[model samples]
Target: MLFRQLFDPETSTYTYLVADEGNGEAALIDPVLARVDRDRRLIEELGLTLEYAIETHLHADHVTGGGKLRELTGCQTVIPEKAPATCADRVLQDGEVLQIGEIPVRAIATWGHTDSHMAYLVNRDRVLTGDSLLIRGCGRTDFQSGDAGTLYDSISQRLFALPDETLVYPGHDYRGYTVSTIGEEKRFNPRLARRDRSDFIELMANLNLPHPQRIAEALPANAQCGCLSETP
Candidate 1:
């Protein structure tokens, strides 16, 4: 498998590129709208064909590039089953796999940051956790149908259950950290480590995080797969 992690400095968002080295078939996960051209060019330079642009959920931070990617590459736009993106070309349910060449990307339902969200486990090794789990912290559960209790369950019961060796690639990171192992997070994450469900819930409730700057514009555009009624 071939994998590359790209970052959007403005939003602290991370977009991932995954491909089969042998087949040169590729997919981009959690693509940000402003970085579509860069991602498209990189895929071209890598001698790969874009097959899918996948979204973990309807984002509130930045607009997605999925709609524009489809226009640019004729790739399908994929979203988690319960996401409100009716414009998506494909909707994946929990445990369903999207095959990119010889690689298998399995969607794990981890809904808390949003009512519908997924973490993609690529090649059974690394997991791209989109806004569900971050480095040493988890996503804020205060909006977009977010619930602290539900988020706690999803993290403890779904994500933390993965093998300790699994690599975690989060959707966004503000602290400049690139990657972490599930084991490391299990042992060190301030939000989850040794914290019971109730404690976790209370902590999340008191985070007092300010809403994303782009929420008003992002949510509506994201609902249409980030089209803004037309590909930008």
Candidate 2:
């Protein structure tokens, strides 16, 4: 297995490249439109064939590169089931596994950051927690039909149930963090530490965070897999 974490500094987004080294087949998760060329170059340099461009949800912060990647590499575009990405080549349901050569990317429904979202558990070890669970904080549940209480449940009941040693790779990180263990986040995440669901809900409700600068442009574009021409 080969794994590389790529970042988009502008949006603090993390795009991941996962592949089966033996077969040289790869998948790019949560790619950003602006960074597509860079990602493509890396894939080519590594002698890998791009097999899929996957998204965890329809993002409100940055546009996806799925559509362009499909055009450039002929790789399929995959989004979580019910994400409103009509252009997606496939929609992954919870517990469904998509194979990238010999590697298995299992979808774990972790909604609430967005009404439809998924965290991919790669090869049963690391979990690509796309805004579901962060290092010491979690995503804001203030828009895109986000529900604080539901997010609390998903993190506590679903994510926390995984092995403590499991690696947690978040979708975005503003604080320079690169990775964390499930146990570390479970014990230290200020957002979820000892708060009950209700408390967590209240905390999230009062965050008063401003909306993402690109929401107006990103939402519609992301829904179409980031084909700006089709964005409205």
Predictions in order: lDDT: 0.93, 0.94
Which segments of candidate 1 are over 4 A away from where they belong?
229-232
109-211, model 1: which lDDT tens digit per residue? 9988988999999999999999998999999989999988888888888888999999999999999999998999999999999999889888988889899
Misplaced by over 4 Å in model 2 are 230-232
The worst-scoring run of ten residues by lDDT in candidate 1 lies at 223-232
Model 2 / residue 188 / CA error / Å? 0.3
Q: Taking the tens digit of each residue's C-alpha lDDT, what string does model 2 give over 146-223?
A: 999889989999999999999999999999999999999989999999889989998998999999999999999998
Each candidate's TM vs. the true structure?
Answer: 0.97, 0.98
lDDT, residue 147, model 1? 83
In model 1, pairs of residues that clash are none
The lDDT, on a scale of 0 to 1, for candidate 2 is 0.94
Q: Which 10 residues in a row give candidate 2 its minimum summed lDDT? A: 223-232
